[model samples]
Target chain A: MSIRYAILGFLSANPLSGYDLKKLFEESSVFHWSGNNNQVYRTLVELHNEGLVTQEVQQQADYPARKIYTITEKGLAELRQWVLSEPELPQIKSSFLVQLAWADQLEADALDDLLRKYDAEIHDQLIVVQEHKRRSKTSPQRTPREAYLWEAIMDNKILYYETELNWVRTVRETLNEMGKDK
Target chain B: MSIRYAILGFLSANPLSGYDLKKLFEESSVFHWSGNNNQVYRTLVELHNEGLVTQEVQQQADYPARKIYTITEKGLAELRQWVLSEPELPQIKSSFLVQLAWADQLEADALDDLLRKYDAEIHDQLIVVQEHKRRSKTSPQRTPREAYLWEAIMDNKILYYETELNWVRTVRETLNEMGKDK
Candidate 1:
């Protein structure tokens, strides 16, 4: 159901083919909020069948005609309704925390290895987020609100990465001290 | 499997009854985690049967003897393995986006109402996250790393809330302009 809105939101902005949507999602930091080719294609078909979007088959010089989707008036209304509606609260079902809750079962050596892995993964994420921040700057028409929103989002991402790194280091030190006690 | 670790982790930190463990999760934002009594009791029974935790009966002054659980070495070993391993990345699945994708089904007025609902919810979440930050500061013994880690987690929560709020506002303005065209 959520995927339905995602497609509408994109089409509301501009007409696009399912392939174009997939490309945008993968190539952008917004990839975090993305769908696969199958989802995009299926939804486009559904929307076209429902008359929410009008599809035009345009021939390419060297390829098969593409089915491009544009939002219909009814579709725009639906999109507007969705944009205004309250978002459902996200649920956290992290498997990482589940593992952490049972960390006492781990040997000191294994715990150290785990902490290291967490550190590295967080570091990698930090790099990706930083790159996203850099890319956002290329768009010249961003409003003040959009600027602040992106800043807040990037700051939060960086903060999480930094925090996780700190936690791993702290745990590593604590484990080392325990080893000395033995 | 996740529930098993949560029970074992709590026992590893200190011997606790099923009721006590439930209280701990509720009392602290340690994991921003939660569960009901039914789930708690069921996990405890499972862990006991698995020999991951040993239970001791302790009599209280005016109540039935409580069963306290302590983590077994075997449980600790299992927890260590989970911590060391890399977990599968969590995918973001949002219904709001789906609603937008199918927006052509809705009326203009309906769309506006949805945006207002989103605005109110984001504001509400922002208040809760801010309050949680203020309340967390009462604990003085936390290390700089722990403090940063906690702040970072809150920052992420706040960031997402702000992002949705800004998006709603922008979409609303766009809808208004499009209305004028009609």
Candidate 2:
């Protein structure tokens, strides 16, 4: 799956312990993809079983020994193959949309309240995304190419939220019009 | 989950046999939500266990006996509760974005090819969505309110694909520019 390839891609960049991968995944933009500690460890085990990654335990002076993972040559090859392969269609399951689909079941006033609440939620999200974009833009650590791709991802996220906000406003306006007519 | 409520929503509209539910699910816009027969049946059993639904065997003259499911009062209450509750945040796991995140690993040509292929795929999907919209508009069985909600869902789908198509084109252009400067 894409998670496996995401792991391989991270490993391809540099060697990382399971704990390190978990931290990086959580702290980075990759958090949007949402991999948890258990998933990270389980995926590492699977990748090791597949001979795509190797693990070595490093003993520390005072801390507990930790296992470090490195991508093998096969891992790199597989990662490249995955990058160039056909991307899987995104699986979208929007609970908001589901509610909207059945919105007619609710009274006009109740539906108006629902849309207003959802609109506020999306507005908060848009602020977060915009802040992330601002931070990413100023970060000197990113290579020009990396920055370009990162911006692309951020732009995608921004556009998505904006589109949703626009839809919410339009739906709210239409609902208001319907109410007035009645 | 949402699927349970989706089933309840449909049953709230009308009593349906298991086979009827399966057919309706597959043939309707609800297919975007992605439920299978096994899941439908399993959820039905769960709903029955919860006293949210009841089933009766209806004998057909030409066909085998079928179990028809009807939403109980509890089921209707649950469905309305779900419709009014805070919607879950949409979980997005886009393989294309995953690929883009690691795209620097691939050669420029390979990345270019990937974008082109993705663009073509989105174009094909837009055609399908547009066709569905046209058919839904002409369906006379929908009430004015139902038609409005359905149109909102269709508009959401159309906007999403359009946004994706635009992103694909922009990314491809940026990649092309990156290639020329190199």
Interface RMSD for candidates 1 onward, in order: 6.5, 1.6
C-alpha lDDT values of all predictions: 0.63, 0.80
Please state the error at residue B125 of candidate 2 in Å.
1.4
- For model 2, the local distance difference test gives 0.80
User: Candidate 1, residues B137-166: lDDT per residue as tens digits?
Assistant: 422323443344345445545655666667
Model 2, A6-31: lDDT tens digits are 78877877888988877766655534
- Candidates' TM-scores? 0.57, 0.92
Mark the 10 consecutive residues where model 2 chain A has the least summed lDDT. Answer: A136-145
Q: For model 2, how does the per-residue alpha-carbon lDDT over B69-156 read when each residue is reduced to its tens digit?
A: 9999999998899999986556666788878878886778888888899899888878887888888732223467767877887888
Error of 2 at B95 (Å): 0.8
Which docking band does candidate 2 fall into? medium
Q: Candidate 1 chain B — worst ten consecutive residues by lDDT sum?
A: B137-146
**For every candidate, C-alpha RMSD to the true structure in Å:** 7.9, 2.5
TM-score of 1: 0.57
